[model samples]
Target: MERRTISVTGMSCNGCEQNVESALQNIEGVTRVEADRGGDTVEIVTEDDVADDDIEAAIENAGYDVAT
Candidate 1:
C-alpha cells in the first residue's frame, strides 16, 4: 500500500476531521484515511498509486486547505 501525510488547515473539530476523512475515503483505491483535527493533518493509505491532485481535490472539496 501507499501512504501519505498531508498537513491540513481549517479543521477545528471532530466533525471537520470526519468530513476530510469521508472525502478521502470516497476516492477509488483509498484503503484508509485519518484526519486529525488536533494535529491538523491527514494521512491516507491506498492500495495502489494515486495522484496528488486527486487527494488535494478531495481536501479542497471538504472545505480545507492542504499545505504542500
Candidate 2:
C-alpha cells in the first residue's frame, strides 16, 4: 500500500472532517482515509496508484480545498 498525506483546507469541524474522509474513502483505489481537522490534512492508504489531481478534485467536490 502507498500512503499519502494531503493537506486540506476549509474544514471547520468534525463533520467537515468526516466529509473529507468519506470523499477520500470513496475513491476507487483508496483503502484507508484519516481526516484530521486539527492538522488540516488527510492521510490516505491505497492499493492503486492515486493521482494528486484526483485527490484534489475529490476534496474540492466535497466543498474543501487541497493544499498543494
Candidate 3:
C-alpha cells in the first residue's frame, strides 16, 4: 500500500473533515482516508498507483485547498 499525508486548508470542523474524506474515498485504489481538521492534514492509503494531482483535484472539488 502507498501512504500519503497531504496538508490542506479551510477545514475548520468535523463536516469539513468528512467532506475531505468523502472526496478522497471516491478515488480508485484508495483504501482508506482520514482527515483531521485540527491538524490541517489528510492521510490516505491506497492499494495501487494514485497520483498526487488527482488527490489535489478531489480536495478542490470538495471546496477546500491543498496546501502547497
* Best model per TM-score: 3
**lDDT winner among the candidates?**
3
**RMSD of candidate 2 to true structure, Å:** 0.9
TM-scores for the candidates: 0.94, 0.92, 0.95
Ranking by lDDT: 3, 1, 2
lDDT of 2 by residue, 17-38 (tens): 9999998888899999999989
- The collision pairs in model 3 are none
Q: Compared with the true structure, what per-residue lDDT tens digits does model 3 show for residues 20-65?
A: 9999999999999999998999999987689888999999999999
lDDT of each: 0.91, 0.90, 0.94
1-68: candidate 1 lDDT, tens digit per residue: 99988999999988999999999999998999999888888999987778889999999998999987
- Which scores better on lDDT, 1 or 2? 1
Counting clashing residue pairs in each candidate, in order, gives 0, 0, 0
Q: Name the regions of candidate 2 deviating beyond 4 angstroms.
A: none
